[model samples]
Structure formats: C-alpha cells, structure tokens
Target: AAGAGAAAGAGAAAEDVPEVERESPAKAPVARRRRTVLLAGTAVVAAVAAAALVVNLVPDKGHNDRSGKQSVGTAASESVDSSPDASEPSGAKGRSASPSASRSGSPTASAPASVSASRSREAAAAQGGDGSADGATAPAVAVNPYKWEDPCSQHYLIDQNPEQVPPPPAEPDARGWVNALGGVAGGQQMLALTVQGTGKATVVLEALHVRVVEKSAPLAWNDFEMGVGCGGGVETTSFGVDLDAGRPSLSPKAGQRDFPYKVSESDPEVFYVFADARTHNVSWYLELDWSSGDRHGAVRLDDKGKPFRTSGNVGRPAYTYPLGDTEWGRNESYPDIPG
Candidate 1:
C-alpha cells in the first residue's frame, strides 16, 4: 500500500510543476537581490534621519553685544578708573572756594560772608516794618477794609463816648471802626465802600429796614483779585476820615423824605450825612476818592446834573457839627458849612 501511495504523490507533483521552475535554478539569486535592495533602502533612511538629528542638535552663531551687560571688558575698566575725576569741574584746580569759605590768611578776621549777609537782610526786614508799611502798632483789625489806615496810628471812631454802641450778637469786645463812608449818621442807611486787609473790598448799602446787601466790587478791585462782600457789621468797616466837611447836609430820597443823609463834594472828597434814627439824632459820612485828587464830582449831581441837595424832610437838630466835635487825627482838616 505504501509503494502505491508514493507512486501516486510523485505523479501529482510532476503534474503540478510549472514550466518556469523546471527551466531555471535562478530563484536563489532573485531572493538575494531582493534582500540587497531592501538593505540599501534601510541604509538611505537611517542616513537621512542622522542628518536631521545633527541639524536639530546644533545651534546658529550670532553677534556678541556687550552694551546690555552690567560689566563690559577693557572699556568698562577705563570708565571705572576715570569716572570720579570726570565728575569734578573741568578746571577745578584753578577754581576758587565759594563765598562761604574764606582764605586762611587770618583765622579770626574771616567772617562767614553768607551768614553776615543773611543777618543783614533779617535786620533790614525787621526795621522796615512788617508786610504792611505801617509799623507794629497798626489797628486791631477785627473787621477792616483793604485801604484802611492804621487804626492804632489814629484814634478810633467811637472814643470813650457814653453813647458808643457795642458790637452785635456774635462778637462783643470788637470796637466800632470809623466807617470809610463819612458824614453817615450812626443809624443812617448809606451805601459804603469797605475794605479788609485780605486784599478785598466790597460795596454795601443799608436799606430802610436795616437790611444790608453787598454790591459788586468796582471793576477795578475785581480785576485786582481783591475779595468782595458786605463786611460783617458796623464795627468792622473802619476807615480814615476826611473830617473837614462840617455842618454836613443830610438828604433823603424824594419818595422817602423823612430820613436824611448828606451828599456833597470838596475837591476829591465826597460826604454823606444821615440821621441816627435809633438815637433820634443826626450825623454825617464822608467818602474820598483815593485815586482821584478830588471828590467824585458827578456823585453830587442829580441824573439831570442838578446840584444834589438833601430832601426837605431830612431835618436838622439845629445843633452844630456833631461829628466834627469828635477827634479824628493829626492831619485831618474839617470842612466849613453854614448851619
């Protein structure tokens, strides 16, 4: 049986054999050539990978900048060596000492010129008086205007008179300063120009009901940066009087004739006279044009340029010169008016 099976297998194998295999022993060489081609391909791939890795591992070269570094080389060393000397003045060896330093020739004779000059300036300032031209005894300016004279230099408005009124509700010791507006009777409502030492000035008028209203500072004071407001009260509005106008007139408005105040001009000075309705008495107020050499003449003229007169209802006590009787100052000159 085994011989028969072997004979059958040989017959089948002979039948399956291809014509190409039967003709050649060249299969081994073909396989070897294929393996050689595969090896060559692998070598090329590895060489390309190695070249890429080399490029990635190495870095490019660049410029060497020293300026950004804290310490550069020889240049920096030279700069460090010369820096301190360069800080000195170019010709420092020949330069003289400042005024504060004196020569060594005489030790005790050398005064500190700077200190001496400072002392002299201080002495001059002390002698020249304070910021105000007036010496130290200026008025106690509880409430005062800008252009007011030294109240201390001159006597006050209300001397030790029994009739002197005390300050209003808030302040008591404050003395009544002479109102800048003269010939104003103690209680009369008059328009007044008042000033304070703060470099401020204002115009205020007392109305019929004793209500005070502040008026605009004249354009001049506003331009000068002076303050503007109605002064606190009667005692605050101090002034240097132009007392020369005596037997002053008191005029009232045409409609309100009962109250009287004076309005008149003597060259550069203008006066306002009024009645102190509280005391049922008469008084006067004077206003001087400090800038003009004479009184503001036009103020005395009516709108129609008529000589300004007190209204008829403004009555007089038939007594002589109430305000003139009070002492004003050394240089003040009183005006003469017919009673």
Candidate 2:
C-alpha cells in the first residue's frame, strides 16, 4: 500500500525561511501518499513517516516557530519541453550531468503543494546551469507530474506557531493551512507523473531517472501534523529511492515493473515515485526518456521551476489537530493503516 502527504524539507537554517510548494499530473494521480516512506513499506507500519518522522526538532523558541517549509506546483502550463534529449534516462545514484524533463500538454494538470532556494542553486550548478532550474521545459510528448490528492490531502507543517494557526474546523483545509503558514511538507516526498506520446504515435517510455541536486543536514523544526488517517494501495508503476544511500538508485518496489512503458495521446501511463531520507534533507527531481518513431527525447520533472525537496523528520515535536479537536495538540498516537 501507498502513503499520503506531499513532502519537501529544507536544510538547517537560523530562523524563519519562506516556504516553497509540490504537483501536476494529466493522466492519473495515483493515491497521493498520506504517510512517508516508512509507512509505505507496509500498512502494518501505519504512517510511521506521519507521526514518527524522527528528526531533530527546532529549538523551543525561535522564528521558525512561525515559519513554514516550501511546497510545489501552484501555477504553470502543462507542456513538454521545447527541445527533447534523445538519450536514454538513468534515474539512478550515478546519473550523468546530462538533464531531462517532462511537461504537460494541457492546462488542466493538477498537483499537491510545498520548497528551498540555496539547494536550488546547488542543483543548477550541478547540472551546469543550462536552464533546467529556470523551468524552461523542452518539447517532446506531453507528460503530467504530481501524485493524486485534493486540497485537503494530508501533509506535515514544520515550525509554525500554534497560536497563529487557526483552529481546525469540521474538515480542515490542510493544503490551505500549510500554504497560509508557509510550511513545507515534512518526512518523505512522493511524486506521480503521467506520460504519453503525441498524436497517434505511441511514445515508448524508456526509463525514469533520479537526480540528487543537493544534500544537507535535515532541518531541525517543530513537526505539525496534517495527516488525519491513511488508507490506499500503490496503484501505479511504483518505484523507490533511499536518499541516505551513498548512491541512491530508482529501484522498482515490490511487485512493480521498472520502466519501459508505452503511451500515446489516447493512452497514457502514470508512475509513482517514493523517496525517503534517514540522515539528510535532499533536493531532487526526475528525468524521463521517450521515443516515438525516429524521434526520442528526455524530460525533467520538478517542483514548479525548482528541484523538489524532502527530509527525514523523525522525533521532532509532533503535533496534530485531530478530528473534532478545535486546538492543535500533541501527536501522542498514530493510526494503524491496513496493508
């Protein structure tokens, strides 16, 4: 089964930092994970990433007590890059400097929200600053990015003052709450993408690659819970990455195919990527390789125009505004999601 919540963690900072955002998909949004990777390992684990993202907590008193983390994809046109790379993708730990990207061909693409800046520069520099960080997408077949979730999709808000955060209503606007506070998604970062060929041609999705733009010490921030509960199964071509690994690779999950799928305007394929970090806050994105007829190219998927971020928030001060609760309280317990 899959978890919920869109996530992007920032590196350690002195005090208040602006939040960024997370998503877009044209084909299908697989069940947006409510939990992070720890919970996705098995339902019995519940969303360990939800309440149990054991990371260093922010100091009890500071500006971060009122700041939020960055999220992704609030606005943008859905289209393939103008110039596509014909080379195959290598979404692995040892990826080359060459870059790839994916875009949506429609304006109706939807995604979840979260973000980071210094890491952005690092990612651009690592990629040789060839405009990949500027959101200048190339042209190829159309593809959608982001997992499936609504405005109320569960998420974690780091280092926000409980006093300023409004009380939870009957149905708390999770996304709106995070956005208002400028908090980022904590724990794990999950991504979903819809890829297809153009016109009547069937585009072959050769491979999906992973690139780590930057890595830093995990943020030490107070954890605010948005996860109400978790329920769902992995329904797409699922893959996993361990951000803590010396060389992380995009390995297929249990019972999941690696890549090499087929799609077209009439037929599209959706992929779910689960990434986790145990020791570092990481900035990353995906690259895809597609070919139709004699023309083939690669596409890069990121958070709006920046690299998506995620971190391991383990034992931070976890809090929640559970159902029926008017005020935010300590997250003393977690749910046991069925596998």
Candidate 3:
C-alpha cells in the first residue's frame, strides 16, 4: 500500500512537468538525441565557410609554374630568330665569311648584286622598313636558282701541252695543273652558263655586262710548243667579249638575240659565253642583272670567285708532240699547226 501510494504521488508530479520535457513511461533515453540534428547542421555550415576562405586566398602552384616556363620558352625562340633591330651575332660570322657558299646555299644572295639589292628593298618596303638600322641584310629564302657547273669541268685552251698526256686526274688536280703552268687561258674561254628559277615564279634576265679588272701584256709563262683540241658548242643565245677592246662588253652573234629573257625551273636557259683575247691578257668577270616580282638584283660570275683570265697567244713559243713521237719536239712554226 506504501509503494502504490508513492507511485501515485510520482505520477501526479509528472503531470505538472511539460509534455516535451517529460520522459516517456517506457523510460526511453530521449535527452541524449534531442539536439543531435541541430548540432550536425551547425558543424556542416562551419566546414563549408572554412573551405570557401581557403579557395579565395591560395593561388594554383601548377598554373604559376606553367606561366614561368612559357616566358622562358619565348625568350629562347627570340634568340634563335633574327631581330630586325640588332646587329648580327657571332653565329652569323660563318655565313658572312663564305660568300660563295652562302651564295649557293641561299636563293636570295645567289642572284646578282642589283637583283639581290632590289629584292631586299622590296622585302623591306613590304614590311614598312628600310632594312635594319645596323645594316644587317634580310634573311635568306630557301629557293635559289643559280646552278653553276664546275669551273674545272669546262675545257680550257692552254698553250702549254702536257709532257705526257695520261688519264685526267680529279678536278682539283686539273685546276692546280693550270695554275702551275702560269696559264691565263690561251685562245678563248668558253663558259657554259645556265639559269632557271627555284619555283614556278619566272625570273627575267635584263642584261649581261662585262667588268674589266686588269689588262696587261700576254703572259710569257704560257709560252709552250704544242696545241691540242679545245672547242665548245653553241646554244640559242651566245655572247662574245673582246678582251683587247678599250672597254670590253658582251656582243651577240650576228643572228643571236639580246637579253630580257624569262626563265623558270621547267624552262631553263643555257648561254654560251665566248671570251677572246688576241693582243692583251685580261682579267674580267660578267655581271648579270635580273628581276622577279618586286625584287631586282645583279650577280657577278667568274671562275670560283676569281676573275676569268684570258691572253692572246699571237707570237708565243711553240712545241709539238706528234702522235707517234715518244718525246716532245720543237715545231718550226709556233702558234700555228701544219696540216
């Protein structure tokens, strides 16, 4: 009866407490879970705010690295490429030292001086400049139209005959032999000159001029006893220059046409150049003027950068090596062969 009365009293006290604050009659532990959802929501909001703050303050390391690498790469490229504002670097000395090699290696400088200068001017004009302030020339284009034959390949008239003609040696040896003989070319030199374009663009050959470097008496070192066959063929166009003249110039044959000819890779032109020196030993070269599009230039032609030399063999000493004879014999008539 005492336990029942105590229970009744506790139940009457529970009725005074708020329903939400009252524990269930089953004795479920509800206080621990009451605010669990609200706490979880507050924790999530705090984590998101911290993440946003970090994102706004820190920069991407990878992006910065790439930008730095790009700047270095740009500088490297600029060093390799030619700049229109500066003088040539030491690297360019190789090109300037060997004009002949450069002439053959690149198309822009391969042409005559006038044509080369003209092309350079036109290129500068196109870019709104007049070349570099330091006087550096323009870069070379890949295409070059000048096709030169070996100077030693062509047959030359040497007044001196070989002691014993054997099979010819290499071209270098042949050139050396001519030099050893003190030969300035006897009779005439027949040079086979060919011209074409690098691409489909046509090049116009305006004129061929002669420049006289030196004139003197016929060389006595070339005085020899015998003469061999030294003849060359002719083409549609041929020019003859009289080295003995006061001012030597190119003259066409009676039927040959003058210059202002056009040429391309598919349609090349072959010209036979005949230089005669009957009285004076002359050192000279040929100047060729040409143009293509807005580019014009002139080029000098010679025997491996040296002027073409020729001398008249009017009254020089002569010898004869008859076909059947084993030793050289003196021919009574020098500079003349008896038929």
Candidate 4:
C-alpha cells in the first residue's frame, strides 16, 4: 500500500491590502513565533539587497496575517525584489531558493499555514447535513457549512456575522458533506477550498491527489469509489482531498512507486495531484493536507483489497500532537481559519 500524499500551495497575495475595522490584538502564541523567527532567520536579512529592496521585503502584519498575504497572487512580488541571482534556503533538506525565488517544502509543495492572528473555537458539528443514501458507498460531504458549530459566534460568518469572513466550508456548494474529495489523475483524491481574507493568507496543504485512469478496458467511471465528509480537525479553507490505494492487494508500503509496484505499460497510472493556492495558469497543482501519508497515497489497490491514503505535510509540524488536547488540530485553531 502507498501512503497518502497531497500538496497545498498558496498562489500569491493580492495587489493591495483591504482595510478592515477591527484591530485584533497580538496573541501570545503568534507573538512568540514571530519573535522566534525574527531573531533566528538571518537569511531574511541577507535577501535585502538595497534601499529599494528593503521597502518591499517586510510582510505587512497590521491589515492581515501572513496567511492572508500568501494567498494574494502578487504579495510576494511586492515584498521581495526579483533578481536572477537572489536565492535562499528554507533550512530544510532538498529545499532551496533560486534567483527567481520559488518556495517549497522539501520536494513537496506544503508550506505552513501562515495564520498568526486571534482565534476562537467551536466543536465540529454537522451543518447542512442530510442522511446518506442507503447502500451508497460514496463518502459523506458538507458543502459550504458554517465555519463554527456555534452558529451565533462573532466569527461564525455564514449568516450570523455578515461582516466577518469565516474559514472556507469544506465544499463550495454548502450542500452535502462527502467522505472525501473525489479521485483525479494519479490515483489521488482532491477538493477545492476558497480562502478569502485580505487574500493575504498562506495556505500550506501537505498532501497530493492520486487518480487511476485506465486506457484499455477502462473501468466504468461509475465504479469509482470515494469517501467524503469532514470529521478530523485538519484545517484549510475547505480543501480538495483524496485517498490512494497502493500495492496490488490491501497491504501498505512507503513512498510513491516501487519496482514491484509497476503497472501495465498499456495503462500506466499517474498518482499525484499538486494543489496550490497561487493564482496561475499552469497545468500542475500544489495541495495541502495534514499528514505525510497524504503525500505517499497510492492509486493501485493493495494486496488486501483496501485502498490506502498517503500522509500530507500539513499536519502539526511537531512529531506529535499535544496529548488530551482536542483543539490541537481543529480547523478553527488557526487565527485566520475562524472560530
């Protein structure tokens, strides 16, 4: 079986920051992180070449968080000067910046969720939910549900807080919650989420989508199976998610492809989806997820006849989550994600 793999990339920030009325005080955790990175990352300083360069390099924190800036398509251009020779290392292996400056996490596209603002909490509740179809194997899904279970909270922006923007509901339509995002090419599953703040948010999806396409004796498209619905605390502004089944049977394995795992030449399957938040006109994509397994997800069925999901890089960065802390991975846990 192949582990799951998903990729989420923040495209670019918008041209201008839209002003808002509220002034969120700096939170303790955010302050700590900011201070730590500020003092530690000397690379940020070396990137500034001249007076004109200095003006654009700093990220604006007053109007929105870093997460908001990252989503804006042009924010990075506004901050850093583009030169053919400017490059920096992210301090991670297999990751380096080039003169043109493309940022990525290890060979994958998972960046961190750059949300550093205030946040509130609510339990994961079912909204806009309908009973599953009897004998329907498709996973349940929630389309554009309320960001918060507490419908009356200040951050719950569906209807209660008209002026506020809520974290993206899992699906775009605000209708049903499926078990997972449907499959695409490369044996991956994916869904789409819209993040709208100042468009400055930095969404780092750590998983990739895997799909199974057959050229000969193609299986009926109807035979495709998926699991959709939101139950975990994984966060993104509504994500395009999918699962992969690696191996010939229901057994598990590591990484994308192995020699024994080769498919028939006539029907070689591509098993990865790169979903990015950057606004672009490219054919490839970068997605975000909560586990590295999301990155290793497989499309081919394993020996046990069970499908497998790869881990995405978007999960908590630490090796482990805080024990007994249910809020640890909550989507609303991030300040930008909404309560």
Error of 1 at 187 (Å): 44
- lDDT of each structure? 0.28, 0.55, 0.59, 0.25
What's model 1's TM-score? 0.15
- Model 1 segments beyond 4 Å from truth? 1-24, 63-339
Each prediction's RMSD to truth: 28.7, 38.5, 17.5, 36.7
lDDT of 4 by residue, 223-321 (tens): 111111324432322223222222111111233332222222122223322222111111222322221111111112221222322222222211111
lDDT of 3: 0.59
Model 1 over residues 203-298: C-alpha lDDT tens digits? 122121111112111111000001112243323322222112233333343233332222112111122222222222222222221111111111
TM-scores of the candidates in the order shown = 0.15, 0.52, 0.52, 0.14
Steric clash count of candidate 4? 115
- Candidate 3 on 55-143: residue-level lDDT in tens? 96687876655566555655554544433324546665444323423333355543444356556666756767644432223212221
The stretch of ten residues in a row with the least summed lDDT in candidate 4 is: 116-125
lDDT string, candidate 2, 189-285, tens digits: 6676665543564657788787889999877666665546645667557888888888788998868877788876667676777787756788887
Q: Candidate 2 vs candidate 4: which has greater lDDT?
A: 2
